[model samples]
Target chain A: MGGLQAGSVGAFKGRDVISILDFTRSDLEELFEAADWFRRRLLDGNVPKLLDGRLVALAFFEPSTRTRLSFEAAAKRLGGETIGFTSEEAISVAKGESFADTIRMLDAYADIIVVRHKYEGAALYAAEVAEKPVVNAGDGRQHHPTQAMIDLYTVKLLFGSPDGLVYAVLGDLRYSRAAISFLYGLTLYKPKRVYLVSPPQLRIREEVEMVLRERGLPYREASDITEVIEEVDVLYVVRIQRERFPDPMEYEKVRGSYRVTPELVKKGKPTLRILHPLPKVDEIDPRVDSMPQAAYFFQASLGVPLRMALLTMILGVYAG
Target chain B: MGPVPDSELLVRKIREGTVIDHIPAGRALAVLRILGITGREGFRVAVVMNVESRKLGRKDIVKVEGRLLKPHEVDVIALIAPTATINIVKDYKVVEKRRVKIPRLVEGVLKCKNPTCITRKKGEYIRSRFRLVSEKPVILQCVYCGTLLHEDEILAQVLGEQE
Candidate 1:
């Protein structure tokens, strides 16, 4: 929290939130502080008009509900207007318009752009071609920086600090952008250790392992989720999407391999909390939702203030 | 191999071209592949692989007798053969000599290995872009996908021919 007090808002003005690796420990702390400020203001029934005339463009070439709507709501609550499309069907892209041209056209209309694309590097490509700042909502299996930010904020709020905590990321490690982003965000804090639990076919990607090695952070990979459930402080879960597999039989083999049942939750540490970047199909049992350790809904709600803080910082309009 | 001979003796002097020397043995072909230097007509190319060297225990040298390499081509060579040196020969004398250094940014030369990477999509005109992250391990991260690629992947995914 000391880093938050020492940060200046001008540092992030006009910056592109392309990847979590682009941020440092202090940058994340500063964002969390800003989010806390916004949250308090909302509780007091005051909507800050810091971005009264700004325009945010949401260009989602992929389907999304939580990330797209949260970002739109964040911009609107900040007293800014928004204009953009939710799907490729709603845009000129269906007519064979190039990605660069779409970004260029959006750049001319909006102050900032938020993009989510099915292609891995689409957001970075858009950021390269556009004049306006681009925020990557979710880009293929690569990154979702804002989702990472909200996740970090959620964990920090729950534990009072993210330091000295053990995190276990379970299921679909290779294809989950949220898991990658969350791991990158966790590197900012001095965590106890990170355990990657998944089927070997869906184990953590080498790119993420390289980051952990470079940071000198201790991590272990295990095929069984139950092996680390009792030891870790947080269990970050991601869905195993059948669409990501080339063969339907391959997806069927691992479909229910890592489900978090009430029985499994009972064996976890009393202080353990569970989280998922949701729209989940059947990864978590419905019975676990009523438990005190279920934090996915709260985690989803944190997106509003976290994204508002991000927009405010990137736009350089946050007064406090 | 009784005694190591000078590289100049292995490949004849080039009047006006480029000499890629000090390449690790067995990697001359990879360097050629990366530079897109096929054994095509209208170019005099000499490739001496597994040659003895004092600096490198065993090395390869490629002497092109008619043309100097472009700067970007030199960068590609550096990625493949970090120890290789580029020598521009003019009028049968080495005029310019320098070791290859990895460029900060590489564009259109290599494709991202991720199948879902936008640069690989059929209709999209996205060029493959990578930022050189580590030279020793020859690591490059795709600017778009954020996927880290190593030397093996680089060799495999690099565009076969300029388009």
Candidate 2:
């Protein structure tokens, strides 16, 4: 499954990595291997402490819960010290320091910067001006490469491999950057089928469809989650990002197109695992959380290993 | 070639000035609306419209005698007509023949990005700073609301705002 993506990035020298698409199959494979290696060392109690003196700085211009804590956890586990803002309310950024200058200032102090900003391409902009390495924790509604990495890693861990798998991605395809990056990342593989379940107004973008065409990955969409739930090997759910939408009234119109519950899974396949890049509002009912096939927790758990792999690869902390 | 056809652009040269050539047709007014051109008496101005250009289908040129367009004005013009070239003419010899470069931090080229932020749907001053994120792909960031503006959409929107 990992081919040119593995190698095009010859020896990772801590470059400015902003998107998962920048990585080849070879690069992903290397990342996965390095992360799995780190995961093994911690579990075995002979941890090598490869990045003891390294410092990772996080600058988040928006509110975050899981992403902020999870990225900090990933960096700390790598034997690196971390410092940053979970929210922008207290920073000098609130007093009108432009993003470029802030990034430039951080470049002198920190070895790597993991930033989440509200504006699209802000991560790319930070990566552009900074001489040190920068990673996109998530940027606006544009890309979430690390989260997509965790999602794919969870699929691999669960099913052994991602080859010839059919998955149903439900809810808010248009405004959900997670869904967009997930679908974009998945399309790089030859998935058997991808059922994009969203309302009529929130279909996967044509730009997304064009990338699917480029990779020759097959896909289709439906308004009903029930229509394709039985056929999928996995059911990936995403919340409609109401905050990303400028108008609240538009969000009201498309809120209930798909709702997952234990009742919805009554006769569902035992092997059909459900995944959500979460902070889920009502899309996945709480009753569904206790079910045997609920993999969102496990999905979230995969973030550590995946990001450990990602950080090591990008920073060259691992034995090459 | 033959006395530079029509030659209505016969304003006297200055020791130092900028000549903006090949602006798209019907945009001379917008360019003139830029600072120091409309009511200021010192800077001599030359406006030529309906000129021939295979690239623009039609063109206009504004030559400012004894002055030059500011960095802000160049950013404004680059938003409208990327092909419009700015020449720094000193003593009738040309230098710096290229399209105006949009600055990374822009002021006075646009308004707020929010629909409800009192700029999109109203007549209030559509003024804001912008940051250039990508040059080839051309994404602009609004300073007020931090929205990334798709390149041509805002350019077209500003065209409507001018009228």
**Residue-wise C-alpha lDDT for candidate 1, range B5-41, written one tens digit per residue:** 6666766677899989998887887787777789884
Best by lDDT: 1
Off-target runs (Cα >4 Å) in candidate 2 are A1-11, A95-98, A205-217, A266-269, B1-24, B31-45, B50-155, B158-163
lDDT per residue, candidate 1, A1-320, as tens digits?
01121344465778888888889888888889999999998789797888899999999988889998998898999899999898888778888888878889999999999998888878877887887789998888889899899888899999999899999999898888899889888877889999989998898778778787888767788988887788989999999967667789999888988899998899998889999988787999999999988999999999889889999998888877
Model 1, which residues run further than 4 Å from truth? A1-9, B1-13, B21-33, B36-72, B79-84, B98-105, B133-137, B156-163
Determine the iRMS, in angstroms, of model 1. Answer: 1.6
Interface RMSD for every prediction, one decimal? Answer: 1.6, 9.6
Best by DockQ: 1
What's the residue-level lDDT of A54 in candidate 1?
94
Candidates in order: C-alpha RMSD to true structure: 4.6, 6.7
What TM value does model 1 have? Answer: 0.86
Model 2 chain A weakest lDDT span, ten residues long? A1-10
* TM-score of every candidate: 0.86, 0.74
